[model samples]
Target: MQKHALPETVGKNIKTKLMLSATPLRRLSQATATAALGLTMLTAIGTDPAKAVNLKTFNISGNFASTALDGSIGLPVNLANGSFNGAYTVDVDQLPASNSFVNLTSWNVNLVNENTVLGTLSNSLAGNTAYIQENKLAFSDAGLLTNENKNLYSLELDFDSNFTGTGITNDGKFLDNSDLGSVKSSGLTAVTFVKIEPVPEPQNLAGTAVIATIGLWLRRKQKG
Candidate 1:
């Protein structure tokens, strides 16, 4: 068996633990004695690729003012005026370009008022137009060089403007990102633009957060 660097106290414990499976130590090179102790730590470092973040499911959550738009719509819960949770999957294991807009393969979001999940809206049903987009570059509209910029730290989601389907309220209205979240001068938004982001992996012993992005964007949902 191979031995790696480990502290003296832990090395002794390993020596006792691995005795039945391995040979007894004939001599101590100080480093050779360190065997069996660092197996757990070494296995973790060697198998990093297998543990990399392949970010498959996205969990979305956000709040709306108590006086937003759902009141007049007659939803069971005031989702437009309160908070809700939604999620989506692109079926692919990657993200879109920082400046590109692409449709999601499927999505599911709760049509929740302040305290109730009236229903869940999903792509399995009709009118599920979910997409992700970001604007990392500043564009010059008519050569004026607009100073506006979308966040590079977080990704945002938008459904079709007021997509009405199974979740439509009594008045025949649904709550979505109604093309209102404009982070740039170009003016683009939906019923709501809730930020999407990857919950960062806990820092390693070296204090480094290993964030493996599939494409780009989707780091954290901090608006710029």
Candidate 2:
């Protein structure tokens, strides 16, 4: 039996060498597959696409004194003597071009009258908070350019103050005060605006790419 096994092993070795010459392509194909897998693994580990862009901020103000003629107050005429005393702001993902305007979503009014019961009418943050987010009366548009070459967005708000009066008694509703009868108060005392931006869109990023050479270099090297 031992003598027979030795002769079979020798015959198998001889056949293996003959088969290599007949199908050298099999060995070449195996080597090529192994190399491709190695390259693919390296790329997956080293060429991850993850990055973030910077954030932007914008300064804005809301005008509580703009007249109804300018599409601000819903009232017929000026009711607050063009005296707007509210705070507001507007922000976009990026700076808008000229002629661009943002819709006014909603707002809260902290109407304050010095002669009210609490010395101040209502604090918007308090229980008497009166808000108007439903009406689409407020909006902002890119303002006229200034000497500093900066563009601003203007916000407008208007009010009515003719139903109450300071001379008779403290009715607590300064908005109804008749002293500023039929006059719409719309203007600003203090204002602020802020905006933030995220990464560019995929198409925009592709268009702005300055470097797409890493993969190209690798492919060229592999070909060589």
Candidate 3:
């Protein structure tokens, strides 16, 4: 007995289904490769050194005794992962001056549960120089400044007697004598704290490398 032949439409339908299935697999592979390449690029970006520097600015505006002081202080820090672990710089600019000499001897940076002393900038001006001065203070131990609380920090300025003047004043008192008295500036009128966080280096270098390798493989597969 002769078997009936299959219909032509049946063969066409089977061929169409097989083609559709193959197309989906190819598309899925390509999509996976594209995603891997994107991940690799992100890893490379995370490990780049150029993006690891963070800059912040704090402004102090208020009266220091009878003189009004206002300026922007720059804080440039290097971060590893999410923590500070490198050299940092504090730049003071637009310092205020009055008829009497004003010397900034030291500054105290107060964070949560910790206080840091920044003392005697290398280029700090002293004596009876009645002029505005700018200073740059560099510290290598910025890791100590980090705190879990990211709130605004306070700055306290310490001034020696030389800040007033070196000569004897009308009251027959030597204004520049450190033993006589010292000045501390606080009670800021306007305090503005700014924090800038740059892109940090990858915390896990090995993981990043593995991710990059996988991404490269995916890209090659896509190209092939």
Candidate 4:
């Protein structure tokens, strides 16, 4: 379901300037067609307590400005147009204590396909509470992981750990009447990074107030 809205400002400055990576092979834009993420390898990041960090959002975007559908090879995503967005948040607390994939309350992506195929889909996307995990994030249609193949329009996005330097690594499948005829399914990809932090607690003004009151009382006593 929809959660926090993705931040619109995440990758504003770098949109057109991001040159496509120099990957040599060509890629197809179809849902079934998988592309290599990039020279940086994507590995499954396990639950490491030492590396755990607070829940944060990631805004992912890139201009597909190269020929042959060239772009960064990050992980797959939920069959999504919304799920695959510029602003995506995830919670990565240390395991056993508690952890989850924060539902994206809102979604927006800045994808300019300078070339072609495989990008964000429609709003039919949804997520599962069970898919939440330590150092991981995931989303799909309304049901379990297995049901993705059956939906009329569906997509999936899985992130190993958004806290890393390369940004959110994603893997996913997508299906729409346009991509697969009547077949139901989903996937898209983006690799930019942004995080949301809790607002700081208001300064401890109560103590200052009490001190001021005492000082006033002392002054009054001296005057008397």
Candidate 5:
């Protein structure tokens, strides 16, 4: 599902320079490949809350330029073989409440490769929610855990807790086929980082609004 359109401005400056180059752009254009390389690292953080733990807001940077592939990696002849893979460091602080036994109340990741939209997927955690939460740890390598055999891509981490589960969440299908043409054709190896925030509960905001409104009414009555 297309949620928010990625900032077209995100790669505008770089793309312009590439257009001026004499080389004909092809699948996995150099410029776009680099961008995808960078975006992937940044996108990993959205996999969990632990990544942005302390800051009011923070972004985990992805270095697409460093890791993006050119049609060399295993991919279809018709598809840009610019497959990229890397590991991002995600801290426990970013995922605290859940790791501290809260488990994942809800989590989702939206992946778009080359301007193609990838649908969102998530795990309710089911009965294993508690174990998942408690097993969450701050200091761990958030993995770009992809399975070549299964063609699965996931952002994963080992919690410093003992729990066993085959799959927590998977986003491979989305990343592989999503409107990745923009990335591949642009010849830009790119990284796709996603910024995530806690979804605010309606009651929390509603309660504050009610209190403020009541206070205002009381003050007006006094003046009258």
Candidate 6:
């Protein structure tokens, strides 16, 4: 039997289609490998102990009448331990005589997730000052400040009267002065809380952008 060759146009079209089809598959494989490698690098960075530690600082400020209060909390973090030393300072300045003569009855710091309290500052303070007071709290446990556990966290303070005066109250997280029979301070009280997270390094940001671009390209390829 004699063999016949296909038409030139048909042969060319078939070759073109094959090449076009193989091009996407090859690119897709490369993209997938790049994405996987990027993710692996990120994971290693997260788990590496030698990397530079990052700390997130949250500053909270509150004011009532003439009293102005500032609070700062710091959490030291790294990938391997995911644990850190937690330190906080609460300062009360420009306190009015009524609220100035107040003692920190019980102060509590919580790692909160929505309505749940994940961790707390176990240390306590008493009789630290005569009328006005400043409290510095620290915890050695590395588990208290891990982002792996919760999405949100907060520090709360409770106060009591050191002298006979109108009850000290806060518009923010401060609770009512249960020791004194006065209601929580109403009006002219405001509190603000701010959280600051460390900025990622340039190399890490570039890696993130690469991963994001790969994801977007994959999505577009699938749509096509």
What TM-score fits each model?
Answer: 0.35, 0.20, 0.24, 0.28, 0.28, 0.23
lDDT of 2 by residue, 61-179 (tens): 22222233333332213332222233332333322313334322223333222322211212322322222222212333223234543322223222223211001111111221111
- What lDDT tens digits, residue by residue, belong to model 4 across residues 1-224? 87885466755535434433222222234322433433123333434444544654444543211212123122232212222334443343432213533344334343233233344332344432223344443333333334334433333334454333123333433332222335333333332332223322235457778889999999999999
* Candidates 4 and 5, the one with greater lDDT: 4
Q: In the order shown, what is each candidate's alpha-carbon RMSD?
A: 21.2, 20.3, 20.7, 32.7, 30.9, 22.3
Candidate 5 lDDT tens digits, 1-224 = 87885588877966877876646666448779889978897797666656333222212212122343454232222223222222122233434334345333334333333544232233432211112344431111113223422222333233333432221321211123212323332122333322223333478789999999999999999999
Candidate 6 colliding pairs, count:
0
lDDT of 3 by residue, 1-224 (tens): 99997899998999999999999999999999999999999898876565332232222211112211333221211000111111112222223233323333332221211123222222222221112222211111121133432222222233334221111111110011011123322222221221222223456567889999999999999999
TM-score result, candidate 4 = 0.28
Best by lDDT: 1
Model 6 — which ten-residue stretch has the worst lDDT? 76-85
Question: Judged by TM-score relative to the true structure, which candidate is superior, 2 or 6?
Answer: 6
Q: Of the pair 2 and 3, which is ahead by TM-score? A: 3
Residue 194 displacement (Å), model 4? 12
User: Taking the tens digit of each residue's C-alpha lDDT, what string does model 6 give over 62-144?
Assistant: 22222322321122110111211223322222232352333322233443333444335433532122223322111222222
Which candidate number would show the highest TM-score if scored against the true structure?
Answer: 1
Ranking by TM-score: 1, 4, 5, 3, 6, 2
Q: What is each predicted model's overall lDDT from 0 to 1?
A: 0.42, 0.34, 0.32, 0.37, 0.36, 0.37
Model 2: residues with Cα > 4 Å off, grouped in runs: 1-97, 104-111, 115-224
**Which regions of candidate 1 are displaced past 4 Å?**
1-55, 69-72, 91-99, 135-224
Model 1 over residues 101-120: C-alpha lDDT tens digits? 54565566765664777556
* Residue 147 miss distance in model 2 (angstroms): 46
